[model samples]
Target: MDDSRAKGPPADADINLTEPAPVEASLTDNPQKLKIAYEQTILYARDLNLKIGELKQAEKALRQNAADLAVLFEASQVFLSQNNIETTLQTACQLIVSRFDLQLSWVGVLTNDENEIHPAAVYPPHDHSDSHPLNQVGASSAAGQELIRQAIHTTQAVASRYSEPEARQAQPAALTDDAYSLAALPLLHNGEVLGVMSVYSRQPDYFTPDRLQILQSFANLTAVALVKARLFERLQLLSQQLVDAQEAERRHIARELHDEIGQTLTAVKINLQAMQRRSGVSDLTASLQESMDIVEQAIQQVRNLSLDLRPSLLDDLGLVATLRWYLDRQARWAGLSTQLTVTPSNLQLPANLETVCFRLVQEALTNALRHAQAQTIQVDLQQHDKELQLVIGDDGLGFEVEPTLKRVAYGKGLGLVGMQERVSLLGGRFELESAPGQGTQIRVFLPVPPALAEDRSA
Candidate 1:
């Protein structure tokens, strides 16, 4: 064969075609296609780059979402920690402005006078310095007042972009000029609108739908706190009224006893003394003296009864003197050995507080004399560091303390329940310690009002 014809193709063609075609390679044994291999490598690199970019974007979004959730949780904790109304609103405003980075945050309650809204609390605009004049108007001003009105009227949350002229005009100059975003959320509980909360930001569209929803949740918590505060106030008022009524009734009864029964006893004693003075035989004289003694005893009994109803000693002398007189008389009458120790004598207390203290002492002594087969009793009173301390102990056969508190038969006559009630009214703590074969001791701790302790020694 000729060499040129045997080569099958020209040298240029053979050199240019470095790899066999797919169909030719399949027919043959092997195929080395470098161009196709290089093209496949380039396509894989492009796909990898695209996947990396997508992953970076997804991570950024996830981080932002986590930050938003953390802020919401912090705001919720702030709302739950407040126990009073004023503090609750203040906390809410601070959280909104600080955590959410808003320019201004405030809360307003609908005024009783249907036309006005009262600003309760506000966080000043972010750019305003603490000493700036504009910072002073967070709680009181025309801007704050009107914002409240708009929130109340809408009843639903309102979010508006500052670029809109209508929205700009509706807002206050301080807010519109300095704040580019604003949102108002209504506070509702049990289908009733209590107030509205408003927030502002320096950047337009700063507050998203998710942020508004979180703010609304804060408003709901505020409503519950306010309701609780109001209810507590009402209860305090009612309790004071009841106390005033009780005092009035006591005064009325005291007057009746002094005017009616007291006068009658005085007249009876006078008549008996007059009869004895009249000339009489020896036998008649002895009989008349005995009758006069009996009349005098009756007079003393009437006086004691009047005192028990309401003690005049409480007003005439201080708590110590009154207690001393009461214990002396009861101990002598009941045939019980009683020792009273009151340190820092002549100390004075408020009339109501004194009355409570006296009654507690009186009841405790009475119970010991009547029920406890004790030989000796001790009453101690002292004052220490803004508190009044009382301890009454008796060397009698002690009984179970729990059963006595429950008024069980073994402790029926202890009067623990009555003593507990009296202590509670004064916002004091009462404790009783007793066990079989041991003496019983009652302890009372009462807080002294600052007004009473001012300028006084403990």
Candidate 2:
């Protein structure tokens, strides 16, 4: 029984005592494996850090993109809802600066000559001084000038660094210390450049390709919005002008009726009553003659009024006859010499086109008489295949063409805008040529509808 506890297990007990523990066995027996495992763990931690950094960058980019999208979406809605171009553009500039953390923002329109960029909308509005500091910076600096030229000439989005020391010196005091990068996106429609949207950013390489694309689209949307707003305003003005023209026509008709017809009828009635009171055959005859004279005068007055309202010849004969009648009448009334020439004497035109042509000549003659103080005016109408061409020229005091066009655009240039609108609505072309002291010339070309052309040929 004592053998179970001692003598048989002596060697086994000695072996167990000499053997290492599990934790120590791993470290001491396989040092290379331990080092490899440690290296692997370290590498895994380093990889995890790198992945985390990449994830953070991705998140940041996502957030920026989201913010950009939000700003653009809101801007679209703002532009859509806004009816005034100035308000729309100003609000857009303000939004861009605030949302994108930009230093400044502006929208510039190319002048008619395309030689200058006039600031249309600006954030942190320029001072009341005659000179716009930022605008001067844009015009004066080489980089700034190139940026504008590139965008306008190429009709694309252009970007340039605006960190030149000289350019910075040209900046206003508020923006002198800060660096800037400028991006110009051309406002384009149907391959024509309307203007440029200039944005300034603090960060370098801020406008990525994606960002630029978004901005270009925004610029395009803005261009369309501006054009729509302009058209809307023009329509409103036209509506008001139409109302005014109707009122004026009504007044004129009323005056003519009162002055000519009413007076003649009153005189005739008085004479007839006098004749009724006196019983002489000669008196009756005299009264009858007087009444007939008055009647003839009244007839002439009515005829004039009718012609003024809408010439019967326009509906009966055509545009050419109406033009001749109106020009003769106006020339006689104004004591101005006038000449009208129509090629292919028997040429025909659409009814509406004829009316338009007549009104255009009438307005032109009126302007020449009233404003131009012209001695002579000439009108020429020609049909060239599928197009009708008209030229109205006057030897009179002229005006600055560009300024006059501006006035017309704003609804001010004595019926010139109306003429342009009429031509444009008919898918026609209108052009004006004038200078100080030189005579004014208006040229219009209207395309003939296929049906009308066919009718003429037939």
Number of the top-ranking candidate, with TM-score as the measure:
1
Clash totals in order: 0, 0
What is the per-residue lDDT of model 2 for residues 1-458, given as tens digits with 9 covering 90 to 100?
23342222332232221222224456667877666555545544555555677679899989978887787788778888776678877876787778777766778887889787877898758665534545544433465677878889889898865555754665555554445677888988777888888877766577778778878877887787788778877776786567457646754675667667767776776766666566468767776767767776776776677567666677778888878888888878888898999987987887668867887888888788888889999999998778899999999998899988888777797598778877865768899998878989999999999987777667
Task: Name the best candidate (by lDDT).
Answer: 2
Residue pairs with colliding backbones in model 1 are none
Q: Write the per-residue lDDT of candidate 1 for residues 78-179, one digit (tens) a residue.
A: 655554577777777777778667766777777776565577777653344543323433334345445555666766666665556544544445443543
All candidates' lDDT scores? 0.68, 0.75
Candidate 2 ranges beyond 4 A from true positions: 1-29, 113-116, 128-136, 162-178, 253-458
Q: On a 0 to 1 TM-score scale, where does candidate 2 land against the true structure?
A: 0.49
